[model samples]
Target: MANENCEILFDYLRSILYDSTPTQIDVHSLDEDFQKLGMGLQFLDHAINELKQCSTALAKGNLSEFNPSRDNFLCDNLKNIHANLEHLTWQAKQVAKGDYSQHVSYMGDFSNSFNQMTEQLKEREEHLKSEAELEKKHAETVNKYNQLLLELIRQSNDDVLITNIDQSTILYSSHNKVRVEQENEILYYFYKNINNPCEWNMKDKDNRYYHIVTINMEWQDKPSFAHFIHDITQEKKEWDRLHQQAHIDALTQVGNRYYFQDEMQQFLNCKTTATLCYCDLDHLKYVNDNYGHDKGDTYICDFVEILKSNIREDDIIARLGGDEFCILFINGSIDSINQKMEFINEEFSKQVVDYPQSFSYGTIYINGNEDTSLLNILQIADQRMYALKRKRKMTT
Candidate 1:
């Protein structure tokens, strides 16, 4: 009986070593000495079964399946791993909720990787926040600038127009509704030189002048042009007044000597055909000495009217001094101009009742090929007039 009990005990121990679940021994059938061994093996089997259940649950990722008892120290390490894994899962949930503050420890390489991932996520989150803030600031800046631009456009004296390259459609106009005719005129001028955006001047139907500036620009992300039209009618009038004061004779309303010189120089530069007539009123000194300066002025004005009536619109007449005048005819024959002058002189003599209001004129034809200076031409004309005056004195 003792040998049979020992053999059964040895076989059970061998089965346990082979990782097989040994059959539980009946401790009551064994003798006193063997019974103790039998009970010890039974306890060993229970512990091994507990460990297998815990290990299987862990293998299947079922952490709740096994709870290690205080006496079951064999699964204490697995219990720690399960606790760590549960905490890590909670940390992962927190991270998913945008919390990168959670950290792990004692998890070897996984801990390092988790910490690195959180750190990188935090950096990325901060970067995104910074970009969002920059975008917000940029948006605010753009809005402010847009408001300022709108206010400036509203306050501007110039009529601001934004349009597509097409002439008829106006995308935006700073001013209120414009008259149809005026709008058409503006668009006509605007599109006339759309291909060449530049500053120019145009006159409206009402004879109002405008200084226009066109610039290529974008409106609502579409290619467009901005037209700034400034009403320069009043300015133009003032400029004309100033020009008249500067370049016109106050008495005769003709061009002054300065104006004549400037026009002659410009005409010379053109190198084109023209005729110059230098004239002197026949008895200006005698009229001033006998009938006072007023009649002399009247005499000068009367001769000026004759010259003006005979000349074309583009022809220039300049009062050089008291009674000497210069008349320029662009592209005319010297003989024809001289005849025109002689007729004017004869007409003036016939009209004069109070005094001799006639004039003597010397004309020179310019073919534009000559490189003669204006002073030289005037000197020759002056000498010819004096010679003609001397001959008239001898004949009369």
Candidate 2:
């Protein structure tokens, strides 16, 4: 359309110029007065009309007639327009081949309307490239974290599992079927009802015990979770071993220091009005002198066994140390205390079974005068034990 319009204007211009043209249409320096110029009044009127139409087009930002041709669309700097089209064509080819880096850039000095448009496309390309790089880095980081998580899963001893707070499955240990199912059941139902320290104990179908500890971790915050369990079989075995150890004397297996002290405290609490019988094997040192310390030790242990067998299960008998021993009478009444004393005397008189070992008896009554604080009471009982020793010496 613009080319046709140009042709039409040029044709009209030729008609007027040929009949009465401005061989030199300089407005000033015309070589002739305005009335003498070619086309005279008729040419002046056409020139004025053409100038007004062009001016109107310029003011409306449409200085040329509308034509769809690419060449006519070049409003300014034809070189810049050419470069822009080449860049756009290259970008299109790259897009077709799946590359996105080609972008339009005109010569810096060629500031034109095309420059603004290409600069905008350049900015958009840079933004997209940056966004793609960020996404790539994020994916790499997530892959690394997942790799580390996979390694950790391999090394764990307890059956580890993860789940949503809503009881949806996330992950679990591979080899442990019975435990995972049991633990999953427990965590599914119990965690919400209890305080958040959500803990439970389970025995798997394998009869293996596990102490499960559940902890909630924040992620997408839709109650994603993790769990750990500890197998307690070895711990249970140690406990049983310790429990057996706790009740027996290391040397004699009668009662350990702990058991003896516990029994003493309980006996004292309940049997207040009781007699404490303190005894020592009579000639233990003489035996150590004649035979070796080994034989003397053997004699003492044998003596303790005899005392234990002779006493009631309710009776707490202990080897105080070396050759000395102690016993408590739950029956603290005078008759009962005396009867226990008589029995010990009778056993002393009768014993010599194989290797002779007899103990001297010392009886102390619970009464108004003795300082009965545990240690003091034992001290008082020992003192009375020595006085009984003196009487034995006289009899011997």
Which candidate has the highest lDDT of all? Answer: 1
Per-residue lDDT over 138-205 for candidate 2, one digit per residue giving the tens place of the 0 to 100 score: 87897798679767766666666666656556554534433546765655544545425467766546
**Clashing residue pairs in candidate 2, if any?**
165-223
C-alpha displacement of 175 in model 2, angstroms?
6.6
**C-alpha RMSD between model 2 and the true structure:** 14.4
Residue 356 error, candidate 1, Å: 2.5
Model 2 quality (TM-score):
0.43
Report the lDDT tens digits of candidate 1 across residue range 332-392: 7888888888888888889936887778778888778979899889998998898889999
Model 1 root mean square deviation, Cα atoms: 10.7
CA lDDT of each candidate? Answer: 0.84, 0.61
Which residue pairs in candidate 1 have backbone atoms (N, alpha carbon, C) closer than 3 angstroms, thus clashing?
none
Cα displacement (Å) at residue 45, model 1: 43
